[model samples]
Target: MVTRILSENEQDLRLAGEIIAAGGLVAFPTETVYGLGANALDPDAVRKIYEAKGRPSDNPTIVHIADESALKQLTWRVTPDMQRLARKYWPGPLTMVVPRRDTVPNVTTGNLDTVGVRMPDHVTARALIQAAGCPIAAPSANLSGKPSPTTVEHVIDDMDGRIDAIIRSTPCTIGIESTVIDMTGELPMILRPGFITREDVARTLGKDILVDPTLNEKPEPGVEFRPKAPGMKYKHYAPEADMIIFEGETEAVEAAMDEERAERESLGQKVVVIRYSQEDTETAAHEFFAALREADKDKADIILAAALPQEGIGFSVMNRMLKSAGYNVRKV
Candidate 1:
């Protein structure tokens, strides 16, 4: 299958949309990450996404819309609080999971009764969706269990020949997935963390938001747990090399990394170190996945990362770091 690399011009955007309208795959950029998109209303089209990325069928995908009014067609109900959240964060890095209408295919929602939806804050992404003329069910464009693509090159690295086309654009501004919140419960619960923090959502709705325990605690060994959203039940955003995170005070973590670097280097191992202050989460979030990809590019034998404080956006960055390290964190 030949994959066409399309520019961000009007003609190419229309071409990308036509591919989607024909039940074909198109990888396009969003503010958060590049997403492999298919028409949400078409089950066969949605299945192509899973096959291209080798993603598990049970892992749900998020539906991207061009306008707020489109939500009426996809969701069964839209509450007052849902409207409040949409008003505040719809065109940003936030996804709300709500009850799915019959029109949404079971394959798209991973057989769950609810579906995740978002309105991206990128012109190219919105334009492509508008051209497609239907809600797009998309997940991160990269192959499953690898780092999510933030740049067109990253998308090409994973999906070049596997998908139909890629809408070339600027690197993603926010280098992580959106914050996924389940709106079906009594209180809105965060299933995945992203640039949008819990405080931001809490402030928007004027109430406390529940953070899912699984966000901090991995499921027990040999446990059968079904994820409510993407990045919940899988080892996602991982690099090829083994990774370990050092968690503690900055000085202690740095010292531990230095010692580990020396020890590994003595054994003729190539080590990569990633260090960030707790307050510098914005930079961390923007560069984390790319750094992981670079480490793999360098053929690093081991990757060492410094831990960030588990609060605010720092908590969100740590979530990805912990997963990339396969929860192999050491308290220094």
Candidate 2:
């Protein structure tokens, strides 16, 4: 199937929407990452997304809405806290998992009772959703378990012929997926970390939030782990090369990376080393996935990445870095 590359104009946006309304797939940019979108109410359309990405059916997709009023149609219960969070962080890089209404297909929710929903803060994304006239269920447009696409080129690299159309727009501002929080509990628990930090959510709700242990540690061997959200129970955002993360003081980590680079070079192996200041988590978040993709483009044999301190947005950046490295962290 030939995929149509659409511009971010009114005419092309309408065409993209028509494709979605007709139970077809389209990849469009969000502030965070490009999403493979299908009508949330159409199970068959939603299934196409899983097929295109080779994503596991059991992993859920986030529903993107154009306005706040649409939230009530998708979710059964919207608590006072949910409203407050919507008021504060709805049009940003944050996803709240809430009870799903019967209208939302079980396939979209990954056979779970809840669904993740968010209102993206991008004009093109919102315009496309508005034109489609239904909530859109979308996950990152990249192939499953690979780096999320932040540019139209990255989306084309993975999904050009696999999907119907791709809305070419500016590169994503935040180069990672949105923060996913389960709002079913007494306090919101973060299932996936993104540009939105735990502190930001806690401050918005005036209470402390919980972080899933799996974010920082892998599940035990031989245990069946069902993820509550995306990026929880998968080897996501990984490059083609062997990757290792070094965690410790800046000087020690840099020295260790240098030694590893030299040793690998002596063995006639190509190596790529990623280094960033512990305090610059925003830049780290914006560039982490793209860096992994670049390493793959260079055909590096091994990738050595500097581990950031797990605090604030740094904690969120580490989540993706650790996963891309497959949790191979060495502390000096």
- Per-residue error for 284 in candidate 2, Å, reads 0.6
lDDT of 2 by residue, 167-229 (tens): 999889988899999999988999998888999889989998999977778667787866779
Pairs in steric clash, model 2: none
Each candidate: what lDDT?
A: 0.94, 0.92
Q: Best by lDDT, which number? A: 1
Any residue pairs clashing in model 1, and if so which?
Answer: none
* Residue 19 alpha-carbon offset, candidate 2, angstroms: 0.3
